[model samples]
Target chain A: MIEIVSAERCVACDKCVLACPTNVFDRGPGGVPVVARQEDCQTCYMCEAYCPVDALFVAPHTHPLPAGSPLREEPEVAGAGLLGSYRERIGWGRGRVPGARLAVGPDLDRAGPAPAAGRAPAGPARGARD
Target chain B: MRLDADVLVLGGGPAGAWAALGAAEAGASVVLADKGYLGTSGAAAGGGNNLWYLPPDPGLRAAAIAGRQRLGGLLTDVDWMARVQEETFRQVNRLASWGYPFPRDASGQERRSSLQGPEYMRRMRRRVHRGGVRILDHHPALELLADEAGVVTGAAGLRRQEGFARWEVRAGAVVLATGGCAFLSRAFGLNVDTGDGHLMAAELGAELSGMEFSAVYGASPEFGNHTKGLMMQYATYYDERGRPLGTAGPAGRDLLARRLAAGERVFARLDRAPAALREAMRRSQPNYFLPMEKAGIDVFTQPYPLRLVLEGTVRGTGGLRLSGEDCATTVPGLYAAGDVATRELVTGAASGGGSLNGAWAISSGTWAGAGAARFAGTRGPLPPPGALRPAGRAGMRPGGPGVGRAEVDAFVAAVQERVLPLRHNYFRTAEGLTESLRLLDPLWEQARDRLGAAPGDGRTALRAREAAALAAHARWMYRSALARAESRGVHRREDRPAAGPGLAHRLLVSGLDRVAVRRDPVAPRLLTGAGVP
Candidate 1:
């Protein structure tokens, strides 16, 4: 579930509101989007990924975190660079290499000569960059 | 609000986007109504997808088709496979021409066979807009409208962003690219994929094919919601005693499922994966590793508990049956595409997994869109509102007064119990299936007769419809499973341990209150040139 939307870092761009598939966020005072329907968050991280200023923090838990947990304010959490990490990983914003450049196609030879009933070849090998 | 269009495409995933583009290019006025934001909605928007992008090399294409023929239970159509390959090849290159930023190989040649989900959908949404298609984000179509002759003419839905205001679109034709049902299993980005299209189309007398194969499952962390199973190919499984489970390769899914069914805690480590590829995996699928990284677990080395998340018809090969190569359904002016249409034409009884489905979405979406455009062109003009009748039954036009919130919640929970468990869905038996039906049948009755929402409460109405759709979907799946008494592809019936020669036909399922199933034989020509007996 989403944990926080930092007011200081937020640009009030409304990108997260438009990008969220479930409409979990509602634009609030001062143009900032509040997590109005936190329960509807599917934890897909689209809000975090689309945030331009890295203002959002989405915990990986499928359910809501405990109230007033210190983990929300821990420097280690931010120090570990978990905030807006999905955007960085996908090479989305500034100074990032596009992740689309890393994708590889399937090797046709792996289909093999003989038919393997009930066992189709696995999809393209993930992370096979080399 | 009332709108008119030459074509009204429902659900704004890859299929719906492509459909809108195809219709616009054909000079049809198009309107795309999505249940959520276009670029980020549906299953394809949340993960990387591989396309079946075989070049026009006859030998390679022939080899690709033959390899998966037997695996698909010999129900695949060779011509359809070739057509999809050809169409996918054309479309991806077109995307590249439109500046899709495809990755280059070591030799600097562009690789057009794979796609990053976020980038792909973002580009598709932009292209659809540029093509003059009107997009209505956060608009969920609740029902289809048919004319006096029973021809589907338009649809009615609620604008969820506008205080549940009613919106209706009268179109010359309609295309349903609404994806498939995951039974609310929380598979990544599939929460909105509740078989809405299937239920709406079925209400208008459309049949579903290969629903028996709806038991597909993907491995995920027990505490997380990501269902990307590609990384698990290299992982090794262990039992609660820290002993190796000895399950190897994709064929070992049955063994792993059996152990899981026996009440054993299953754990896995990606120790077998090449260390060099870890960074690339993170780059390729960033969301897949987020849960583990946040929980401070090294998935590459440390053991983590795992469970199978049911993907239902989303990954499984079953949905609205197509009656033509143009992707039209049995109902006039109604067409199906993407996961909403059965993949038996290309994938047969097996799941498309990613590649085949990705390609099918592009190919079928284009075909269905153009087909719908051509269909609308033949009709002179949109029918008058008086001539059209709303076809939605269970939720839209309930037989009795609306049920309460508690009843709707109970219906969803009851459905999850019968459908989500691996023991019930994966390791199937006649007794287990019959027992599931006994419980699910009455729920269908309640959904059809009493399950409804009070006026102006769109959220509750959507939930009610979703509950009805899930129940309707489960009944179709179990009834089809019972009819196909064989262990073929993903429809594994433990009691019938072997595939029956006579059961080689695709099972067609239809009906509302009382579900029914029948065998539709594959044409003899479709079975040839694929090494089938």
Candidate 2:
């Protein structure tokens, strides 16, 4: 299951909504994003990882397996290099694979809008933390 | 500052959503305001409490009715209760039919049950939206407005992330669906709950029905304040020999079922156990507690675990007073539901998903809201200039996020010095709670004062959220602990050890005009009825 987004905690900043690989959230008229399609959750913790406020929780899925930093797998975009090929092989939209585990991440941008300003470097920052 | 909606639901959990949807479907222009985001209210959060009393067979229907009848005053109208039950089933069924995966039971029946905690939250949130409940997140209701005759007019609150963004929403009917005061005692340090809905309703002079029956729940043992792991991990309390303690029965399901049927409230106490069972518990790996890495390995292995726990965490059962069907207090137009309302037949074992019970709240909230709206219509909407400041608005001094090195250092020292290792569990005494209050209050205040500017732009807002929750928590604990001369259910009193007579069914009400406590007058054994004592 996709983690819970403390929507109350959400600043309506649209960071995760824009960063999503799928257009899962539809920004409502009131400026908050609506869970446009919750069923599409691939159980990826990307949204949680990227949530600066730590307002999300992905369930039943284990936390990133304990490992030494840097080498530790980033939850959603685990294998970016692999994901790129997977998306291309399936001929899915930008960064999306036809059926290969459609969780909340993938460096592949997919069908969503451009990533937010501070979000583009998520991979490197994640790597740096590792 | 002025806003318009056909129906304004004060809370955004299961009850609020159902009420909003029903109102909207009934052709009301609906606006739902939640202090938290969608799916995070009393219903969604805290392991949703949607429970149905199903019989092992059709023959047990009579048994169920008999059980209800035996309880008498303890039992809500079975027909009305059944109506709430049917509506809940319909809503859950509607959610499942929409493709949300609600796990089925052994009989392949839609479990139609809320295991409780965050898992239930996720499911209910998904289900509410899938069911088309529109929500306005982060809008916490601050005040319930009333006119000259004490009729409730409307409500107002602030936008958390947005500084000073105030909203005054006018509704045809206003439903107070805000969840109860658990976050109050745990966080705020107040003895009595922060009294959000109660305070607002009191401002309108609404007569709260049951102010004494406090909704009590055990704090998460080991993991201070987390309620999830207890629900999902099904952490069974066992002796050193691995024999289940308390209402011991094999398996979590069997034990819980037996306890509830017998009207026995469940509580978890820490104690030492044999190495074998300790190892088994260790292997089971409860999630809510601090990881062994943090609290220490023996944390789980030890007996009489000295930790704040989460068990029978009542969100105020005998807390507020209210009449039947009408979630109304003594004051007209002011209504309560979820945790803030009355804890009657709907409380304890009769509930399921927190939000799933939105139907219950909706029935009451709708009546209250419509009544309030009708009242408002007579007085006319409070003019834009007349928008009232939210009642109970504590103007907290702003500060930065992340405790400072000095504060952290002080906290560690204080914990080492004053934090007793004794079972500082819920069985509170006047001196103990007072001692805790004296020790913890200064630290909390000092931290709030000394902390530099809130770190992030929204840090001030976040701190306010934390402070409000903390204040409410402190108020609830101190007041409830002080009020209850005896211990019962979740509220264990160290001063008065055993359950006293004549106070069991008698409800407790805080001066705030909400039902604060409800006790069975006499133990069940003493009663002619069939309820468990």
Candidate 3:
């Protein structure tokens, strides 16, 4: 579930609100979005990925973390640059190289010759990695 | 608000976007309504997918189809398999031409087979918007509208972002690309995929095929929701005592499920994966690793508890039955695409997983769109509002008094209890299936006569309908499963352990309160072509 939205780093663009599939966030005072319906968060990390300024911190728990949890502290989260880490990891934002180049799977084009009728292919299954 | 379009597409995943694009390209005005943000909704938006992108080599194509045919229990049509391959090839290249930024190989050859979900959906949304398709995000279709002659004409839904206001669209044809049901198993971005399309189409007398195959599951960390199977492909299983469980690969899931069902804890470590491939896996599916990283567990080195999350019809190969190559349902003016339509034509009794399903979404969406456009072109003008009747019955216009929150919650919980458990759904027996039906059949009646939300309570209303759909879906699945009487593909019947001869036919299910299942004989050759059976 989502833990925090950093006020200092936030640009108040409301992208998280628009990007959230489950409507977990609502527009807050000063244009920033608040985690209004935290229970509805599916922990899919779209809000964290869509945040442009690295303002959102979504804990990876499917259920909500306790309020007293240390991850809720802004300094603990922001100081470690944990906010919007998903975006960075996915190489989605500015100046990051596309991560698709690193993808590995069966080479369909060069999987040797086709197998005999009713027989399994000779090479590794093409879509096994998917 | 009221809108008019030549074609109205529901659900804004890969299928719906492609449908809208196909319709627009066919010179038809299109409107797409998504329950969530277009680029952030449905299972396809949440993870990576591999396409069944075979080149036009007959040898390679035949080999591919034959391989899957064996895996899919000999029910796949060779003609459909070849057609999907051709369409996926063309569409992937088209995406490249539109600057989709496909990854290049070591020799600088673009790899058009796989897609990174986030980037893929973002580009698809932009492409569809540029194609002159009106997009209404956060609009969930409540029901289909039918003319006096029982032909589908339009649909009504709620605009969740606009103060829960009601919205309707009159269209010459309606395409349901609403994906499939995950039953709110928290499987990544499938929260919006509540089997609404299945319920809506079924209400309109549309039949469902392969629903008994809706028992698909994926391994995930107990605390995380990502159910992509790629990483789990390398993991080794263990019991709570840290002893090796001796289970590996796809077949190992049955053992893991049995142990878990027996009240034993399960754990896994990705030690079996090649060290060189770890980085590539992380980079390819970054989200899959995020939860483990945050929990301070190095999935590569540390053993963590895992659970098999039910993906239901989302990854499963059952849904609204198709009647033609154009992806139209039995109901005229009502078409199904993506996971919403049964993938049995290409995948047969097996789950399409990522590759075949991704390809099916592209091919079916395109064909359904063009077909709907042609359908609309011949229908003259949109029917008047008075001539159209709302076909939603169970949840929207209940016969009894309105149901409360508790009832809706109970219905959903009851459904999950029957469908989510491994013992109940995975290792099925005749006794267990009959018991499940004994419970679910009554819930169907309650859904029809007793479930309703108060006026303007959009959230509760949506929940009521989802509960109805889940209940209805559960019945269709169990009914078909009981009728099969033999283990084939994902529908494992413990009593009847072997695939019975003369049982290779597909099961077609229809009806609402009294769900019915019948065997539909598979034609020797669905379409004339090379490699006909």
**Model 1 C-alpha lDDT per residue in residues B1-533, reported as the tens digit of each score:** 99999999998999999999989999999999999989999888888787888999987888878756656777788889989989999999999999887888668899888888888899999999999999999899999999888888999999887899989999999999999999888778888899999999999999999898888887778777887666665677888888877543555566677777787778988776666667766666576776688878898889888777788888888999999999999889999999999988888877787888899999999999999999999987667876789998886567777877677878899999999998899888999999999999999888888888877767788889999999999999999999999987788898998999767778899998879898875551353554433
Candidate 3 chain B: worst-modelled 10 consecutive residues by lDDT: B524-533
lDDT of 3 by residue, B205-313 (tens): 9999999988887777888777766666567788888888754454467677888889888898877766766776677668777777877789888888878888888
Q: Give me candidate 3's TM-score against the actual structure.
A: 0.95
Local accuracy of candidate 2 as per-residue lDDT tens digits, B158-250: 665355476777654566666554333231111112345554554454443333233233323332333332222223454345566442112
A92-117: candidate 3 lDDT, tens digit per residue: 88899866555444442233233323
Model 3 ranges off by over 4 Å:
A105-129, B522-533
- The ten-residue window of minimal lDDT in model 2 chain B covers B185-194
Query: What DockQ do you compute for every candidate structure?
Result: 0.37, 0.03, 0.37
Native contacts recovered, in order, as a fraction for each?
0.39, 0.00, 0.40
DockQ ranking, high to low: 3, 1, 2
Better of 2 and 3 by TM-score: 3
* Candidate 1 chain A weakest lDDT stretch, 10 residues: A121-130
**Considering only N, C-alpha and C atoms within 3 Å, which residue pairs clash in candidate 1?**
none
Q: For candidate 2, write residues A1-130 as lDDT tens digits.
A: 3334555556777755643322246666555666665533333233443344444443422222233432122333233221122123212244432221111111111322333333322111001000
